[model samples]
Target: MDVSFLGGPHPQRGVGVVAPFDFALDRELWRWVPAEVSLHLTRTPFVPVEVSLDLARLVSEHETLGDAVRALNAVAPEVVAYACTSGSFVGGVAGEKAMREAMTRAGALPSLTTSGALLDALTELGARRIALVTPYTVSVTQSLEEYLAEAGITVTDRAFMGLTRHIWKVPYRDVADMARRAARGHADALFIS
Candidate 1:
């Protein structure tokens, strides 16, 4: 019965995540996180609208992001991340930067948005051209494309589901099929959004 020699529990680092109210991929997010780091997640306030440019605007408002960041600050996360593709890209590159700035202003923590992270990943991979698959309307997909273009990346081929809601409900087989179609022609990378 001698268990006193065991070491103390490791202190967990925290990462704050601000997700859209409709986001259903919390488990997916956790899959990439390490055991030593904890994710403190908050959702934007619910808005009565389908997934669209307007909904993206509402969820990614500076005030909403500030409030979410303030809430997450209570947990003292080392960094904060906004976890919405359309919301972060709807306004393009400038919008994504503004969201990160707003979150930092609210919590004084390093901040990033999904769109910004995607751009960073592309740059890191030296991927100048990519094929894209999205479960969003044409307009939303166009916004994402514009955002990528602003970062000097090109979408050589693309496919979309034209969906305004229930994006998570899309079957994997369909997504794979779309990816296969989109990945046609030469591309440095394949992006599924």
Candidate 2:
């Protein structure tokens, strides 16, 4: 397995990076996903929602998926990840499917979304009942909860901050606080994903 990093030109942007608020905690686990000959990353931090021209609003979807595809194709990466959770889930299945097709059409590369990875990990862990925590608005959080439940996992508890932008502004203290709540009782697992 191989991995390469891409982001801004400055030292703060590229490899050995630590996002202020990474929806995907400890991306180090993806050590096995990269390859020597096929690695392409772009200087675009994974933001779940973007300015959607069609919708004329900042929706929880990947409007820059096209940019992602371009970056992948330009570098010819065999495997790539969009690296946003709520955005991918916000897109729901359809939006994700669109991303796959978009990547295919642009460079014929395979793409992965954080949401998809979460579902896979959840299944592997046999997590039937789980708790969800995020800094999204009530509407977005509710939608995410509904989506997870539809995936055959039961969300016993949920917490949201009703936040829209500056997702990194969410304090770690709050996340830790929620972790405590999510782990209080016995549920299959607590999904910080």
How does each model score on lDDT? 0.93, 0.58
Candidate 1 segments whose C-alpha is farther than 4 A from its true place: 1-8
lDDT of 1 by residue, 1-193 (tens): 2233566666789999999999998988999999788999999999999989999999999999999999998999999999998999988888889999999999998999988899999989999999999999998899899889988999999999999889888899999999999999799999999
Off by over 4 Å in 2: 1-40, 43-63
State how far residue 165 of model 1 sits from its true place (Å): 1.0
> By lDDT, who's the top model here?
1
True-vs-predicted CA distance for residue 8, candidate 1, Å: 4.3
- Each prediction's TM-score versus the true structure: 0.95, 0.67
Cα miss at 160, model 2 (Å)? 1.7
lDDT of 1: 0.93
Model 1 CA RMSD to the hidden true structure, in angstroms: 2.5
User: How does residue 131 of candidate 2 score in lDDT?
Assistant: 83
| lDDT at position 134, candidate 2 | 73
> Candidate 2 versus the native: TM-score?
0.67
